[model samples]
Target: MDTPLSGSGNLPPKPGNRPPLSLSGLDFKLLRVFKAVVEAGGFSAAQNELNVGLAAISKQISDLEIRLGMRLCTRGREGFCLTEEGKLVYQASIDLFASVDSFRDRLSSAQNELTGDLNIGVIDNTFQDPNSPLIAALRVLHDEAPKVRLRLHASPLDDIERGIVEGRLIVGVVPVYQRREEFDYFDLYQETSNAYCAMGHPLFDVDEHEIDVDVLRGCEVVNHRYALHGDKANFVTLDGQSATASQVEAVAMLVMTGRFIGFLPEHFAAHLVRDGVLRALRPDLINIRTNLNMILRHNAPRSPLVKAFATALGVDLKAL
Candidate 1:
């Protein structure tokens, strides 16, 4: 009855002629040089740091400019400066190199029995607190991972967040006045703010009743520019400027001049308070409470070192 049909009639032959995707050419050496130049602030400095000839550095940068079809730097007698494109490229290079460094660190950690690099960012005031959990955690990390290299960066909260976002810092500890949805913040500790001044300051002996907000209205106050607060209600605006000091130590030093009073975290000012170097003003007047948090990018892939550090820090990585 009908023609015999072979099983191959219904099946299509396998295709074997697909072409592979072509990848864009990238010169890692040029990228490295670009990053070095940006960091060193000029070609000569980068040449010195990289230990290369001036001509070689120049050629490499020129090649990079040609490859990207953009003028990266402006060369003149006033010294070298990055152009708009150069600025963007420099930022990109920073991120790229940071990722490469992290990758290398992870690989080295895996290969070596006990070694790795951990990049961490902390607010200046956090470390100054004698009872800070970070100090204890660092001690534990040192004991447990003795061979691991630790890199700590202390800066303002905004800079710390930028470092984390740019992949420069693996983790950050910052004061959380408001929650950010893009990052995961683990509550570490809670603290209260209080007015502080040097032992010799006039306000040091002021009575609680006289230490009201009105009294602070006319007094010179040194405010920490990076402190977490919404309203800044109790702050005494000196010269109509809100930011005078970026670090808590700077604020403390300013207060030591006996010319200004500052608001400081209870734990941060505890030692000075105990040693009679600084006194609190109307302890009841300062009622702002804030929580210190361990922040990390929500979608970042955690390496073994990061996981271990998080565990040591008493953070539940899985939950985060």
Candidate 2:
């Protein structure tokens, strides 16, 4: 007779029966407050964070529950706790704010005033190479997007490549040994390295004629961990490997100990050689030539900053 009053005793109508809520500015404000309250663990704890009084926050939460036609949280003696519906809403709020922030970043990028982060990963010792365009590209990025924050990480090639694939880095500069399908490689330049011995090593003062392949093969050497997989390993015999290093700097340290021989990029070794700190073992017989490349995920869309960097590096986008 009386339409059963919608749910038998004035309880809020079932979720399916209620009309959907159309979000307004006020709704956003209320949700923001609700988010702060939940994050702070209770209304009283959120006062300093929200900069509002307890009564005002309580009123806002009550208003939000009324507008949604659902109980969002429980408070008082039992302590603040979210209802099942409240938990779902809180999770959705997180995703919603992220999308909003992304939209803002997109708008800023479109206006040519990029103000988000640009993460770049590179293999160590690249800055010392006069041929690398990385320094010039960084200068260009700084001049153009002065507001953008540039984050640079120097690590091993394998770590750099992994960072690019996992979206932790926008771009990576590394030596290409074997190309992976996951990356779009843009050629940067080549580097040359030769085996060397430090000042205190036995061969540092040995005559060239006395250092034959057999003599070198019998000496202790340091092997690059990453180069063990391909032809790169074949450049120098690994039979004498008594130590392993992941970085060129580490290799230098080992070589300097006068107990191991290791390969180093010519440019990186030049100053050390000039200072009489190291001497090349046999450049003519033991050397490796590697092409360095800039890599990005083949499937991911390039960010504006990445595009700018590629342009600065003179990479032919059409080829990629």
Candidate 3:
């Protein structure tokens, strides 16, 4: 009897059937090239993006199509377009590459070589306190994971929370006065803010007297615009300014000029008080206690890098 030919007519086949391809059999490099081509809108654009020669890219695409036994792209005068099969393949490629990247990030983090970009949003006032433990933790994290890049964003508490929710920020350090169910919170510390003013301000000398709320009615207050709740009516608003020096040094510089009175964390004003640049307006005034929280998306995938950074900050990720 004559031997049967293989499906591709390359050789005569045995009785057994061909084995199916596994995940490993998928050429990630080729898939990446294909994805770049689709996204770049043409072969030339793909060449520029992939930094590969035009002939090489074309050969790779042709090889990929031959291996799959299907045409993935259609080229015409208008431009390159994806066929139905190409669209499906591109979607799969997106998901596959995203998972692979996550896996690599996790592996790197586990090896304690956690090196990657971390975009962190923070309430500008959190760093105002000179004794803020968060600052110390950041320094330690840098010393340990020097390869990890840190991007600091300063915004209002509401804006910071919004950034975390919309996936712009990987993490946020904010006051948890307005906790929402959609967010996960890690308690960093508790801070107390007291009203303060310039040393020579009239309110600074008020003692043994119940300071009338009217006294502050017309005063120009340099408010830390991020405070969730505070005396709102008495202030000439300088909104969106930070009360924290370490994070918002420019705002602090303005504060140092003694042109405005504002609420400041007690720890932040100690040194400035000693230097007589600022002083408490009324030591007996109402104090506001706020919890400093590390906020992240509730449903966000926990990456090893994020966990490591949280650990360094004394946050129990398990509880979160």
Estimate, for each residue in 27-51, the C-alpha lDDT of model 1 and write its tens digit: 5677778877875678888877789
User: Candidate 1 or 2, higher TM-score?
Assistant: 1
The CA root-mean-square deviation of candidate 2, after full C-alpha superposition on the true structure, stands at: 10.9
CA lDDT of every candidate: 0.75, 0.80, 0.69
Best by lDDT: 2
Residue 108 CA error for candidate 3 (Å)? 1.8
Candidate 1: give the clashing pairs: none
TM-score of candidate 1 to 2 decimals: 0.69
- Spell out the clash pairs found in candidate 3: 128-244
Winner by TM-score between candidate 3 and candidate 2: 2
**In every candidate, how many clashes are there?**
0, 0, 1
- For this target, which candidate reaches the highest TM-score against the unseen true structure? 1
**Model 3, residue 80: displacement in angstroms?**
28
- Runs off by more than 4 Å, candidate 2: 1-105, 229-235
Instruction: Residues 1-320, candidate 2: write the lDDT tens digits.
Output: 11112223323556766666798887788888898898678999999979989988887887777667778999999999999999887777755654554576689887867776677899898798999999998898899878878888888988888767655567888888889999999998998888899988989999997876677777788887775445444545676467989888898999999988888899988999999999997788878888989898896666566677899888876687
Assess the local accuracy of residue 307 in candidate 2 as a C-alpha lDDT between 0 and 100.
75
Taking all chains together, each candidate's TM-score versus the true structure is 0.69, 0.66, 0.56
lDDT of 3 by residue, 27-123 (tens): 6777888988986677888888799888777777766665555578877687788889888887787667656657878889667687766768877
